[model samples]
Target: MSGTSGSYNAVTWLLDRNVDEGRGAKLAFTDTVSELTYGDLQRQTRCVANMLRRLGVRREERVAMIMLDTTDFPSVFLGAIRAGIVPVPLNTLLTTDQYAYVLADSRARVLFVSEALYPVVKDIVGRMPDLEHVVVSGNDAFGHKKLSDELAGENESFATVPTHAEEPAFWLYSSGSTGMPKGVRHLHSNLQATAETYGEQVLGIKESDVCLSAAKLFFAYGLGNALTFPMSVGASTVLNAERPTPARMYELLNRYNPTIFYGAPTLFASMLNDAATKNERAGTGLRVCTSAGEALPESVGNAWKARFGVDILDGVGSTELLHIFLSNAPGDIKYGCSGRPVPGYKVRLVNEAGEEVPDGEVGELLVEAPSAAEGYWNQRSKTRQTFQGHWTYTGDKYTRDADGRYTFCGRADDMFKVSGIWVSPFEVESALITHPAVLQAAVVPEADSEGLLKPKAFVVLRPDCNTDGLYESLKEHVKQKIGPWKYPRWIDVVDSLPMTATGKIQRFKLRDGAS
Candidate 1:
């Protein structure tokens, strides 16, 4: 298969060769109980692709997918790619209003939904004027077309539509931490480059490995780590339809004995909390574990290693970059640092003037990588602001040590002034996590009587900690760790921290709830 020059897609590169040469390799999908192999997967995807074309899906059009992390999800996703339509996988957990926002923002013509979620989207789908076709993955509900029936008698060998390397292949919505979700568009070449750089350099995945992640397929980190990277290496993947609770995740790990475990810091912390008895249940086949989305504190890294006997390689990536841009690889693992930049990518810390910051100084992180997205869809102003020259400003404030390892400070927007001194919420939050009594913490600026913003913390206590008198103890703990000014002026001990669908702490929600 010659490389596509102005005519290549990720599905084309991933499946074409396999269908022709490596047809016998095994690819398994364990949704709830049933499992399917690579051969079965290929045939099913082709069948669905044939159905999609017959239903009038055309090249370069958008097809929205709103489903859980089931086996059928991947089948539909790859099938859409085969049919020349870009798959826009939306977060299944989004509210009806949020779903409506994304549907309007992307201008998706078709929507593929799972039977389980049809009720949630059924009433709202009628209002989405742009949606013309509805395909259901399981039992037909609300008079929608059955996914299995769509390709019941179709051919399994339709040719993929020719596409340029620079053409949009897929769209992933931004976290919308600040406001409305923006569509982050990526080219076919960007996906391929992600496989080449991070897949090869950081993950070092092999065909013999079995990949699994707690991340849902909707998020780019999960989609790439769970599907694209493993498929690129000819490795099989395990997709759990259920939410990734620590117990369920351990079951998948023990059952399949996956070689690579990819997840975020919150998931890692959950696993550590369950490690007392679950460690012995872990599969010996596991070799590498990775954490992304947010910084993995040194304490969490050390605790995980002590229990699982494997280092958790931490990395930092964004929706704009599509995948992990900076990561510590297998052997040269750093506990706290979100490693050096992956091969073929350059990272810089710049001040407000866009000048390079001195070593050990905190500044905005900017990345120049081939895998970076073209721009946010339909938002030209943001696109221009985010992508300047060859670099994509990450909006993450960080400091590089003398040894060149990047340490996450906090989001540039999350930095607040306390007593006329700048304070990073991440620094305070990370320090809070180090105490055994704290599970997770989010720090925000709460306005005082004079309308002056001061640091306040919302803390989730660990399982063993007593809730009584905990707030004062935590405040004192912070006072001892950093200084008098860094201590939270007010502390709210909560049952849990509110998080986005992708597991990021919704600091804005916490801040709003404080008042």
Candidate 2:
């Protein structure tokens, strides 16, 4: 029988494997305030498991983690998994109403919140009838018990529950194009699949490499980058609880000199646009960087490479798939395209009728990966629509080239026709971003005087950019670059564009004219 054949727990596979391999003394995690070696992590994780059991959270029951990225996060997340309890990591930046919605939807028995974020849901915790215990990492304020106090009494001798590899292990609320957040349920085996496929084969993560993810623990990309990938190889991770700003990111990179850095397109743009640090180089130890959540513009990728001498492997992934299934490798880098599918995954593009589209034609992307989520929790119709047989429908549009590289088009809902032809907003935005004055941009279709749909651009120009007649010049620049027909009919300067917490452009909100 295989190692995972009869019974398997991911916690044992991820955490214990490192200890069993004599890596217990090696550092596993480092945050601003403290560090956890592999041995300390194991002990703390076991303590967290015991603490959960003492609270009466049964096996297969859910525990919600509204946690920041810190040493506490790993113990809580992996501990719950070790005891056969599913841990749902909610977005820390979410509003109180959103927290209430997720708590009500998941019916979690326990909530482990960071002390900093406790007040957001302090009043609502008592209102959640399903929540039996509130454990805070820093304080016991507002009637919530301190997580440290609870774990202090618990001995680190709990046995890892024997759970099937296919059991639901965790949940993440997806930030989709147009809908309330939906809980995407992932199985235990899914984490290992991502680690083996993308983490091992694509990124070549090693035991000596240190990782810093600008994205937080609540994100699927960040979870794999900082936790599963590192633990799979017994590497250490640097966690930052606060937001990833340009200055702070630079400081971390200089201090830690991490081998790998995971970031998003927005961060890359901001880092490049900020003149003070735009020319700065991270430590020489930085070997590779990655970008996801949104398509990286070709200009931004080239600028970053020119400055840092490291390629940003632009990839596509979602909460449903757990981590990146399509990515650019180290040597086979492409500036403008989402690289070919990662090994062990199958990708297809189909038209509205679900027929496979030929190369160079736009279609919705569908993926079949080992890490695909089981389904959305308690949402049957949506589950049926997204997951069909072995294939999970990704709500993204793209066109595969003759050589098999996929170029991202706009989202399925965001695409609109202009002049009897479909226009990709990303394509136009990419063209606009290539200009010297344009710092950031978002494109959406708007009706013209003749009632014909045309492209409109909202741009955040560089600090020294003169907007006097700049729109006309930008239009001419775009016309000379992509094509005359695709240039923005109108360009409006804005301080900022609407964006989700994951750094994706909220084009739907821009379309609705919501600031």
Candidate 3:
């Protein structure tokens, strides 16, 4: 592996070098309605690169992508890098205010938005002073530069601009659970390290595999696992431009026969609950399954395996680290634990005093990975507090067993006090999720009239389950599993719990709503 000081760009390396080796290699992109071959993909990307250069997109500038998972995303993503511009992929689902924050924060010079989303931001573009260009993908009301017109009659021999390995290549934003979203910057080498560690070691992707993931390309996990990993191994990928429902996902699997499926635990739970209806269409060529973004309950894991005949390997990753740092391998998976740290990454459990904790004790999980980001962009104080020495202090809390498996407790900030005793929301939430009636659960502290805080639970019930007396039943269930003190004083049954774009339960939302 080359050191970080060397000059290398991931997009140029993967496309140019790989094409020189064998231009006939296969890469497929199948959306809900369309598909493209590797040869078509390579030519389109080069054309887009040449067009962007002709449009005066300068080196070291920021180009924002607000499109969903489509063929154009990869083309424009690689095109930006090939033109020496940093690609900042923004979540299309974010509110206009959130989008404005990112555009202002990144100082994006151009925004490539899909037609469906163009109307949402059409009136707001003038507020973004630094934005110099707007490229709309589909034909609609916005009279912006059409991406198709730009690629018309363009040559496919655009030279990739050479970049230093340490130069900024991309920007991914945090979930903003604690505050406003922070931009986490990564170098080109970080992408390569992530592909080598998580892609090769954990995912075990091969050229023959067809990779499919429910996460969007804007997310770090999806970008690494779904797009970059498969590209690195010369495999095919399935991209759905719409929200991936269980029924729709099953249809895609039946149609495409993807070999590797990656998604969040929430998606897995929904699929497991609705498997019987989709079983007849479920005879796809899936060989491996993976879950991330949140902890996978043992019951969900077991149910998915029973239905799909393949284990759903659980892993934990963060935007700061680029991709999965801990994951269970194919044959070494455990039912109730997130597997040991992946290769090229180090994990440690630290106490409140910042000392190493014993194997059986719960503490903060700190990570040291070659793919970890340099720091939060332009936030020196936060960068200093979060990154200490060579390790990134992940806010997650966990317990390590003697066998080196890790059990997630909760976030360090999520832990709160009740009756002067520390409480872990995940412990109670996990116990609640095991109940047959509960599909999902989120626990948080709520204060009463006396100014004393107590545990409150927000639960999403399974289908055909009566909410009558169900809250009491769940309270008793938790009281019996953990101590009575851990029982929630108030329980609210709802249709769904608030979640971040990455599928993490937003406990702070519950706390705010309850107040």
TM-score of each candidate structure, all chains considered together: 0.95, 0.98, 0.95
Indicate the TM-score of model 1: 0.95
- Residue pairs with clashing backbones, model 2: none
Q: What lDDT score belongs to each candidate, Candidate 1 first?
A: 0.83, 0.91, 0.83
Judged by TM-score relative to the true structure, which candidate is superior, 2 or 3?
A: 2
Q: Which ten residues in a row have the lowest lDDT in candidate 3?
A: 275-284
lDDT of 2 by residue, 143-217 (tens): 778888888879989989999898888898997666679999998999999999999999999999999999998
Q: Report the lDDT tens digits of candidate 1 across residue range 1-515.
A: 23556577677777665656665457656665566677777787788778777878787788899988888887888888777778999988878888888988888888999888888788788889888888888876569788777777789787777777788888899887878889999887877788888888788888788988898889889988777887787788888788888888888888889989998899888877865545545578888898888889888899888878887889988889998898888888888788898999999999899899998887999999888898998899999999998999999998898888888888888887788877888878988988778989999999999998888998888777776777778888888887879888888888888888778888888878876
- lDDT head-to-head 1 vs 2, winner: 2
**What is the model-wide C-alpha lDDT for candidate 3?**
0.83
Question: Which scores better on lDDT, 2 or 3?
Answer: 2
Candidate 3: where are CA atoms >4 Å away? Answer: 3-5, 23-25, 275-281, 418-421, 448-452, 466-469
Per-candidate count of clashing residue pairs (backbone under 3 Å): 3, 0, 0
- Report the lDDT of model 2 for residue 301: 94
Question: After aligning candidate 2 to the native by TM-score, how far in Å is the CA of 491 from where it should be?
Answer: 1.4
Off by over 4 Å in 1: 1-4, 23-25, 275-280, 449-452, 464-469
